[model samples]
Target: MTASVVLKFPVFTVTEFRPLDRQIPKNHPSNSVKTYLPLKTPRFPRQVKARTTLMEAAQSGSSVNTSTNASMKLLFVEMGVGYDQHGQDITAAAMRACRDAISSNSIPAFRRGSIPGVTFGQMKLQIKLGVPHSLQQSLDIRRVKSVFPYGEIVKFEVVDGGMICSSGVLVEEMGDKNDDCYIVNAAVYVGY
Candidate 1:
C-alpha cells in the first residue's frame, strides 16, 4: 500500500506519493518538486487611416485637377511573392505572383478626396518580372499584362533571374517532355 500527500505553494500545488515500506519526512527536499507556469497573451494588428495631401498641378504634371484647379497627391504601395508547382509555365507563375501581391489590397486611389479628377483607368502599373534564363523567351508579355484589369498603362519588363529545379519526372510519358521546374518573380508598381 502507498500513501499520498498534498503540498500547497503560493503559485502552485503539488501532490506526492510514497511507498509504505519507506518513511520519508515531508520537509525533505527530495520529497517534493515545485513548478510554476506563466500564461502568454496573443497580439493583433491595428488599422491606420491613409494619409492625404493637396498639391498644385504644375508640381505633378500627371494628375488632372478637379476643384480649385488643384491636384490631390495619392500614392500606395503593396508587395507579395508567390510560387507555383507542376506547371512549367513561366507566364502563369508570374501572373500568380502578381495576383498574390495585389489580391489582398483594396486601394481606391482614384477617389475625389485623394486624387481629384483621376479615374481608376488613368492609373499606371509597371510590372517587373524575373524569370529563368531558359524560359525568358517563352514568357508571354501579353499574358502578363492581362493580369491587371484596370490600369491604363500596364507594362511588363522581364529580366534574367529566378531558378529551375529538376523534378525527375516526365510529362505524358514523353521522352522530350520538359521535366524541369520553373520559377518566376514579380514586382508590381502602382501609381499615377
Candidate 2:
C-alpha cells in the first residue's frame, strides 16, 4: 500500500467603515463656494446740470453769476479772405486770411480772470480755414500756426471751399502777381 498526505488553506475578507462628516473651515483655499462684497459706482459733476440751473435762473428773472461760470462764450466771429497769385503761396494767403479774421475784433476775454478755472494761457482758438483744393498740399501748417502771437491752443481745419480770383496785377513790390490767386477764408474762435 502507498503513503497518502492531506493539506488545508485559510481565507480572509476586508470590510470598509462609513465615511465621517466634518465641517470645512472658512479660510480653506480649496473651498469651491465663495462670497464677495458689493462695489459702488463713481459719480462725476456734469456741465448740463449747471446749465439747467442757469436756465432756471433766467426763467425766474434772477441775476446769474456770469463771471465765475465755466461755460464758454462765443466772443466774436471774423471772416477774412487772402490771395497769393505769384507763387500760389497758400501759407501767405492763410496768414493774411487769419489776419483779416482778427483785424476787426479784439479779444479781451483773455484778460479777464472772472471765469473760473480759465486763464490767459488757456485761451482756446478754433480756426476754420477754407482753401482751394489745388493749394491744400502747398500750404504749410506750421506757418499758418505762427500767425497767432498770443499763447493759444489753435485747432486748424482746412476745407475745400473758397474763391480763386483771376489776377491781372503784376508781381508788383514782391506781392502776388494775380496770375493764380489762392483764396483762404478763416473763422477764429477764442475762449477759455
By TM-score, who's the top model here? Answer: 2
Candidate 2 achieves a global lDDT of: 0.67
Per-model TM-score versus the true fold? 0.53, 0.55
Worst 10 residues of 1 by lDDT: 65-74
Instruction: Please name the candidate that would achieve the greatest lDDT relative to the true structure.
Output: 2
Give per-residue CA lDDT, model 1, range 1-192, as digits (tens).
888777776767777776778777989875665433443465558777763343343355556443221222335444555444555777777778778778988766565446776776577766777788778888777877777767654455777877787767666543325676666777776666
Range of the 10 consecutive residues with the lowest summed lDDT in candidate 2? 1-10
True lDDT of residue 46, candidate 2: 64
Residue 102 displacement in candidate 1 (angstroms): 1.3
Question: Across residues 60-141, which tens digit of lDDT does each residue of candidate 2 receive?
Answer: 7564564332344434456888777676688898999988888777666566776566678877677788988887888898
RMSD to native for every prediction? 10.4, 22.8
- Looking at model 1, residue 11 earns an lDDT score of 61
Candidate 2 residue 60 Cα shift, in angstroms, is 12
Give stretches of model 1 more than 4 Å off.
1-74, 111-113, 167-178
